[model samples]
Target: MASSSMLLSLFFTILLFFFLSPTLCANSQGNALHAMRSRLSDPNNIMQSWDPTLVNPCTWFHVTCDSNNNVLRLDLGNSNISGSLGPELGDLKHLQYLELYGNNLRGKIPDELGNLESLIGMDLYNNEFKGKIPESFGKLKSIRFLRLNDNKLTGSIPRELANLSNLKVIDVSNNDLCGTIPVDGPFANFHMESFKNNRLNGPELKGLVPYDFGC
Candidate 1:
């Protein structure tokens, strides 16, 4: 027998090059996320529910996947998406839930998204993004739900976010931020609506005022 049919055609050509080399490296990051969705400028077309020929990005439509298909989640909230945020989204290297809430995305927010080191969850809330908040997001230590609430970020709040020890819920509430908010670990069990109505001093709540709770 022709040497067992030449070792069964070299074991099906090494199992078709190990199953087409991880689907050609997950379609080369799904063709760079479909060429960054054609240089987004969605106006108000609201990404027409992002269709890019389905298939990868785990069959599109608010994409979410994992079973080796990669891309975990991308909610696209309040869909009136305006622009900015395309650092080819750090090549979605197994992205974990990125929801752009109340859309109208402006700029900044992208210090290459700290290269999504298996990001847990990031929601860019009530958008109109200004600047500051990107000290590479304290290098997302497998981040656990961080919401940049009511955007227009100013400065200060980055005490390297107290080194996000797998942070469990952080909301940089109502921006134009000032300072001094960094109290001991996890900001002493954050509340007071997570520092609502900024330029904060702290510790007051109950319908603030008295120089907005100048604690």
Candidate 2:
């Protein structure tokens, strides 16, 4: 009888673990977002709902989640929040939209963001970001709209960006980018205005002209 009791106890423990696994994952994603809130300066109290004590971040304002309580979107655009993005943001594996435009945010875009494979739209325009665009961004296979215009970024555009076959609208204009713009893949269909206001020499002319000329 004692052996049967021990077996039942073990089964219950395993069942409990499986039942709590999703909640545990949600808590971890919440902690990642809370880490970001700790680094930012929120003057408008827009992040008041980001209570870490909650089981998940699904209840937080400006945050959206899927039916399974996985984070889906963060709509903090033009909220007057200012701070460099944290690498912890990469923990939102289900995130689709990340809108942080028109702020005073500075520093390099975190290369860790490349881990957001489910990302669809990433809008970081009209900010004060600098440094080279992360080559890791080429891993964003699901990304469609990528707008990083009107910043202070410099360096040659990463050639690896040409691999984003799903990319539809990409505007790197009004920055300090150099080198000839990529002319293959999605870049071939983009208009010159999308690459305007920068120091780009022009489009890549393939073998006739070097793509990195005068960069």
Candidate 3:
């Protein structure tokens, strides 16, 4: 009888662990977002809802979560918040839409952002961001809309970005990018306007012109 009681106890313990697993994951994601909140300068108190004392960040404003409480979206565009992005943002593994456009954020786009494989839309336009665009961004296989226009980013567009089959809209206009545009994959469908005002020489002419010509 004692053995049977012990087995039942073990079963209940396993069940309890499974039930709490989602909460634990939510708490971790919350912490990641809270770390980002702590770094930004929110003069309007827009991030006041980001209370680490809470059970999860799903209840916080501008944060959207999936059914399992995994953070999925962060829409903080044009909120007048100013500050550089933190590497901790890469911790949002399930993030899809990261919209921080039209802010005064300055600094290199974190290479860690490339770790978000589930990302769909990443808008960092109209900011003061500089430095080379992270080559790691080529890993964003799920990305659809990548708009980094009107920034001060330099360096050649990573040739690896041509490998993203899901890319539909891309606008790197008004940046300091160099080199010939990749003529393969999704890049084939993009127009010159999508790359306007940049230092790009033009599209790659295959064997006639080198891909990195004058870059």
Task: Please give the RMSD to the true structure for each candidate, in Å.
Answer: 11.4, 1.7, 1.8
C-alpha lDDT of candidate 3 relative to the true structure: 0.92
Give the number of colliding residue pairs in candidate 2: 0
Clashing pairs in 1: none
Q: Quote the positional error of residue 6 for candidate 2 in Å.
A: 5.4
Query: Which scores better on TM-score, 2 or 3?
Result: 2
- Judged by lDDT, which candidate is best? 2
What clash pairs does model 3 have? none
Candidate 1 per-residue C-alpha lDDT over 39-106 given as tens digits, one digit per residue, 9 for 90 to 100: 65666665565565655556667777777777778777887767777777887877887888888888
lDDT of 2 by residue, 1-215 (tens): 99999999999999999999889889999999999999899999989999999989999999999888899999999999898988999999999999999888999999989999999999999999999899999999999999999999998889889999999999999999998888878999999999899889988787664466555
Question: What is the lDDT, from 0 to 100, of the residue 191 in candidate 2?
Answer: 94
Residue pairs that clash (backbone atoms under 3 angstroms), model 2: none
What's the distance in Å from true for residue 20, model 3?
A: 1.1
lDDT tens digits, residue span 19-118, model 3: 9998998899898888888778999888899999899999999999999999999999998898888888898999999999998899899999999999
Give the whole-model CA lDDT for all candidates, comma-separated.
0.75, 0.92, 0.92
**Candidate 3: TM-score?**
0.93
Q: Report the Cα lDDT for residue 208, model 2.
A: 66
**Model 1 poorest 10 in a row by lDDT:** 206-215
Question: Which regions of candidate 1 fall more than 4 Å away from where they truly are?
Answer: 10-12, 19-23, 26-28, 42-93, 96-117, 121-142, 151-166, 175-188, 193-215
Superposed by TM-score, candidate 3 places the C-alpha of residue 190 at a distance from the truth, in angstroms, of 0.1
